[model samples]
Target: MSRFTSICLGFILMMVSCDERDSNPTFSHDIAKIIYHNCSPCHRPNQIGHFNLLTYTDVKTNANKILYTVKNRLMPPWPADPHYTSFVGEKVLTEKEVGLIETWVKQSCPVGDSSQIPALPTFPIGSMLGTPDLHIPVKPIRLQGNYTDRFLVIKVPFEVPRDSFVSMVEFVPGNTKVVHHVNGDLVRFEFDKKKDVYDGSLVDNLVWDSTIRLVYKKIGLLHDDGSYPTLARSVVNYLPGVIAQKYPEGIGGWKVNRKSAFVLADIHYGPTVDDVWDSSYINIFYAKSIPKRPLQEFQLGTLGVSSIVPPLIIAPDKISTYHSSCTITNDISILTINPHMHLLGKSFWAYALTPEHDTIRLIKIPHWDFNWQNFYTFKKMLKIPAGSTIYIEGVFDNTRDNPYNPNNPPKEVHDNNGSMRTTDEMFQFIITYLPYEEGDENISLE
Candidate 1:
């Protein structure tokens, strides 16, 4: 074809595509599937989402709000940039999907066919994986109506039939609206060392004046002779939009004694206007066999193996950048990673540099959301050779322009010696990995 003819033909095709895309989009036919896949996971009942988006009516009422959030790239809350690296179970929506939601809302959200709408997905109740072998209930805690954040340490003790293997432990928040996050540890007590595992206080408020050793004493985490029991760190954790981490069989499991207790080192709960009671519990899944490999963890920045450069002290009305680095002494295969920060966090990025000067991207969050921090799992195992150094860079905004800043007039904010309070600041990168094995990079972690 001639040049003019080809140009005219291309213009015509482009116009046709635009018309087809902008045509009358309906909720039942065009939008329901997207909402169900991306929004329903947390927007349904008993989840972190403030409202439900299950049925057609439920979505129609919030159509404008949904359109705004998707258009702004705010709602489905995947902080990691997909352009840098990809992860499993990412909830990011495509450009075309966002456009469809916008077009549907602009067209007044018509229900194309009531009978053609797809049925809502069945979300497993209480447990996301399956039925648990045992359920250990945490003692109920009461919160006053005062609008202030509270942090507490609790112990949930249980005795099983005999010594067994635990494949996983899942935390279920009783009050999803107020519960922020939990960092739990497993305490194993010898059957003969302690006669009763459930004899002491189940919960205690965390105060600035109290030391960790004092809190442990108050909660009875010691044995009869006053020696500490075996403790496993980061065994159970929970965040607003995070699913519990699980691996393939024989990958990561723990051997539990007949008498054991789960120690929630720090359980954070957000502010509430009315008094409430929270009765969260832990679900234990028994393993069929002993684990062949156990996960190892290390951290960088606040209270980690590495310290933050220039310290994590931000001044008033300023944006600052800080970094932390750690050198790997042994070859390892990585499974999951979690980047942590408090309210002032603006963005985060982490990567590894090899001795040969090659770079491997780990994760990069262009925009950080304090509410939706997840323990990101890779699709397959990642291998980091020895002599490689991992680096992390985090940016914090402590100005009035930052809506999440806690202070009215941003003051000098410091890490406050690795405090866990929401008002204070912290920066940490926790990595879970195992010693390297042959063909580890080829194993799927999904």
Candidate 2:
């Protein structure tokens, strides 16, 4: 081999290496652009999300955290099933984009050209787009000096000249930062016009004098030991961002009789503030008439997993999977699948197994957020064959490390008796489906 030949080969190899290094996109430009477009809205200043990613510094500092959240599909929280209809403002990233961010972070988050930086996205003042049909507000309530969870019901009087239907409803938080969640229900009659309805039966004066009791008197207890004694906490309508669900098209148009009354109760958790006053409210959007289809929910769980009864402690920080099967007796079109769990819930997934034993993935929440738990409505109706077996699985974490742990020193929780006591955990898979028939249409459960 001659010296000239050796030099030429060496030069060629150096050029190739330089090209590869230069083509490696930096996190500052390519990666940061994705985060700013998708995350900065709520995650920015004074928003509900915990952190901000408004600038290059913010993205650079939390590069690894960003990578983790995006990889897990937890940071840009869109909970609906991807197989369903697509939604506006979805935070889902393409496979290539996710790969780019992951690879960029591994390369030490290199800084690309500053001039190539994209413009930052502008977020709305609130989650809603325009003025709502009806805005219901709750008087500012003072919080205890310590972390406390309180449920309040604010009655909103609606005078329906005739029967009407609701298409879309949004809970506009008077104080978004402090207001944790909101649920609204439409009742036929006015049980109590004014009995301090907003205070979740906490005030003795209101409960004793008011004709309306917090507990649901109609729905009989499903359990034997009385674990779920009263329907005091049952929310007909609820909105929790990232989990705030929209009813199937036919579902939202339920009839509200003339002069009928509806109640909006909000659930709030104040962790940091001890003596802060917070106000929360909701706005409902109604249509003049009902839709063509009707919506119904199928509850699979709340059944005892064991014969041994009362105070079923599943324990925190531990993984416990519960199994339940439902057979579709009649042909039905499913609009949404909502998996419910309390503070100790870590993840919930549901799928359908054909009579032949083939598996169909329904919905999967690998990392669950109790604060953002919601009804995941499919964009399109999911048709299940009659006699199909629907399977559900839920995992719980009761450890002290979980931020949502309600217990001071976490203990074992279980599903015992009929009631869901403080020391117990409840598992349920609530699905919204429409009866299959001709002229059957979609409904919305907003």
Instruction: Choose the strongest candidate by lDDT.
Output: 1
**Positional deviation of 242 in candidate 2, in angstroms?**
3.1
lDDT of 1 at 53: 90
Give TM-scores for every candidate, taking all chains together and pairing residue i with residue i. Answer: 0.91, 0.71
Query: Candidate 2, overall lDDT?
Result: 0.59
The Cα error of candidate 2 at residue 329, in Å, is 1.3
Q: What is the alpha-carbon lDDT for the whole of candidate 1?
A: 0.88
lDDT by residue (tens digit), candidate 1, 1-446: 99999999999999997778557778777789999988998898777788999998999999888988998889898889988888888878998888888888888888888889988888777988799999989888888989988889999999998998999999999988788889988999988888889978988887664556777788888897788889888899998667787899999988899999999988988888999999899999999998989778889998899999989999889999999999998999989899999899999999999999899899999999987788888889999999999999999999999999999989999887766566788899999999999999999987
Model 1, position 379: C-alpha lDDT score: 88
lDDT of 2 by residue, 299-367 (tens): 777752322222235755565666676777787777666676777877777888777777766887777
Residue 248 of model 1: what lDDT?
92
